[model samples]
Target: MVMATTASTAAPTSLSSVTLEVADIEAARRFYTAFGVDTHIHLRASGTQSTGFRGFTLALTVAGPATVDSFVGAAVDAGATVLKPAAKSLWGYSGVVRAPDGTIWKIATSAKKDTGPATREIGEVVLLLGVEDVKATKQVYTDRGLTVAKSFGGKYTEFAAGQSSPVKLALYKRRALAKDLGVPVDGTGSHRIVLGGTADAFTDQDGFVWEAAASPAPTPS
Candidate 1:
C-alpha cells in the first residue's frame, strides 16, 4: 500500500481494512456472501449495545444500472431489507438495503442506463461515516496522515484512494446521510464498525474506532 514518506519507515496513508460488528457472525457471513461483498470486508460477532442508525453506511459502486439491480437483487434475496428501491436519481441509479445485522448499505452507479448485461462485479466500495462535524472529522483524518481527495465545504470529505485497500474512506453529515438513506438520524451507543490500518489504534471524534493491522490488506482480484 502507498503511504506518506517519512524520515524513518513510511506510515500507511489510507485505511487497510474495514470490519463490521454484527450480532450474529455466521448469519452476517452468509448475508455478505450472498450480497457479493464478503470478500471485500471482514466481520466480527459483537454483543455491544447499539441502537438506531450506526452512523455509517458501506456503498458499492458498480458499472451501470443493470449491475446495480443485480447487486440489490442479491442483497434482497439474502434477507436484506430495501430502504430504497433501485431507480434513477439526479446523480445516478441507486438503492439502499439494511442487513439483518442492522448495517446499512447503498448500491449505486453513475450510469442512468445499462450498456451491457448485469454481472456480480463491483467497481468500488466506500465506507461513508456520518459525523456530527464533517470539517472536524476531515481535519482529524488529515492530521493522521491521510490526504484529501475531495472536499465540499463542511458537507463532505473523501480521503485519497487506497491503492491496496479494498475499501475507501469518506465523511458526511449525519442527518444528511440519514436523509439520503431514507432513515432517521439520532443513533446512540456503539458505531458497530472498526477500521484497520497500519497506524496505532484510537477512536475518532465521532466515536469510530481504528486498530493497527498486523499486515497490509489484500486487493480484491
Candidate 2:
C-alpha cells in the first residue's frame, strides 16, 4: 500500500527562476547579451521606483580567476559599473558590477589559478538577498518549505534549490552584504526583483515576492 500527500504536506519548494525588473527591457537585454548572461537571467520592464542598492545581488561562480576576469571585463564593456574590481580574496577571486538596469552582479571563482584559458562559462547563479534579520527570514523560508543547505548563525544561510533548478537562493545581513558589494546600505522603495518557484505565492520577511513557478521555454523541434 502507498500513501498520498496533500498540498499542505507536499515537499519543500525549490527556486526555479529569477526575474529582474528593469526600466528598459530592450536596453537590459542588450547589456545582458553583451555581458554573456542574457540566457540565464530573465528581464521585465516596470516603472516601479527604486533607488541605491536594491538589497540583492546575483552571483556568478565560474571555473577560475581567468574566467572571473573575462566576465568582469565583458560586464564593464557592456556598461556595467565596477563596484569591486576582480581581485584574489582569501576565499576566491571575485568582482562586483552594477548592471545598467540597477541590478548588482558578482562574478567569482574558488580556484585562484586558471587550469586553462578563459571561456564564457558560468557554473552557478546564486540569488542572494540582503535581509534585515537573517535568522527570522531564514525561519520564514524554512517554514514555507525551503530546505537549508548551509547556515552560519545569523550571518548567512543558503537554501538548496535542487540540482535541476536554474537559480540558487541565499540570505545575508543587509549591512554586510552592502559592504561586500561596495555599496551603501540605505535604500528605499521596490527591491525590483521577482522570484519564481514552486512555492505558493507570498512575500518574504523583507518584501521579496515569490510567484508561481515559471514554465520552461519550449524546445526546438
- Identify the candidate with maximal lDDT: 1
Local accuracy by lDDT, each model: 0.86, 0.84
lDDT of 1 at 159: 90
Give the per-residue Cα lDDT of candidate 2 at 142: 79
Per-residue accuracy of model 2 over 115-184 as CA lDDT, tens digit each = 9999999998899999988998888777768899999999999999766577789999999999999999
Cα-lDDT of candidate 1: 0.86
In terms of lDDT, the poorest run of 10 residues in model 2 is 1-10
User: Per-prediction count of colliding residue pairs?
Assistant: 0, 0
What's the lDDT of the predicted structure labeled candidate 2?
Answer: 0.84
Query: TM-score of predicted model 1?
Result: 0.92
What are the clashing pairs of model 2? none
Lowest summed lDDT over 10 consecutive residues: which window, candidate 1? 1-10
Candidate 2 local Cα displacement, residue 60, angstroms: 0.6
RMSD of each: 4.6, 5.8
